[model samples]
Target: MKYIALFRGINVGGNRKVDMKQLRTLFESLGFSQVSTYINSGNILFESELDTKSVLMKIQNCFHNTFDFEIPTIVKTENEMKKIAKSIPEEWQNDPTQRTDVAYLFPEADSKKIIEELPLKIEFLEIRYIKGAIFWNIKRENVNKSQLAKLISHKLYKSMTIRNVNTARFLAGEKE
Candidate 1:
């Protein structure tokens, strides 16, 4: 099956410095086919017959062994990503004033509970859950003032990996 694996908090701001070339080599070494990485943000596309859980475990272990740090990985089949890319509201897709992002939830995350825990309402933020991910947008102008912006330091942030909507679409093969 074809899959896209999103690795969280790696190769970002000089922190968890994972070289894409070596990462791809590791995937190839694991017997995955057509392993390709996207834009240095740790998004990998590959084909493997193993189930999602197996793939996740293998990749996580490889990363830990190679980097000496635990990097959370989220795997999604091509079909799943396609559906998620299409789930964003059209208005948000075209709105230049908004910054749209999709957060791929960990298998153990309860989407309903997370949604319930969010503030009752935030004028500059809009959030929705589709499949196993959360699609949210923050008004560009109000991002600094938006409560949702505080999630970076929140405990909930640890359970998911996030990507800009455009990047998500690109990973889903819906965009160049």
Candidate 2:
């Protein structure tokens, strides 16, 4: 199955500097095929027979052993991506600018509970869950300043990558 591994805190603020080539090598060494790293932010797309949990554990362990540091990782398969893409709330789609942010949640995440705990003033926040993934659409200028994004890192306890609606669609290979 094709999977995307999103790593947190890599190549950010000059801290965890991992070259894409090394990242690809690490994934390939773990038996994944067609390993590709995107945007230098630790987004890796590859194919592996192992399930998501096992893949996560393997990748995390490899990263820890190779880099000597722990970085949260979130794994999602291609099917999961399709489900998340289809689940973008209709209401949010009506106002594109109001829904400029897209967050891809881990397959094991409990989105309902997380949604319920969001801070107020989120303004037009919408979440859809299907096929073991959660898709969040939020209208916000700075994702970091958004309450939903701020709380997600704590709630999921896994690495997360927030792309603008454009980047999310691009990663998902959805037509603009």
- Best-performing candidate as measured by lDDT: 1
Candidate 1 regions exceeding 4 Å error are 94-96, 119-121
For each candidate, C-alpha RMSD in Å? 1.8, 3.8
List the candidate 2 regions with Cα displacement exceeding 4 Å: 89-96, 106-109, 127-160
Candidate 1 per-residue lDDT, tens place, 1-176, comes to: 99999999998889988899998999999999999999999899999999988998888788778887888888999999999988887566536777888889987774667866654346667888877798888778877776676677777788888898888999999889
TM-score of 1: 0.91
Candidate number with greatest TM-score: 1
Model 1 has an lDDT value of 0.84
Q: lDDT for each of the candidates? A: 0.84, 0.67
lDDT digits (tens) for residues 1-176 of candidate 2:
89988777788889978899988988899999988877887788899989988999998788778886777777888766656665665455426356544555555564555555555344545565454444566555534455654564475545245655555555566644
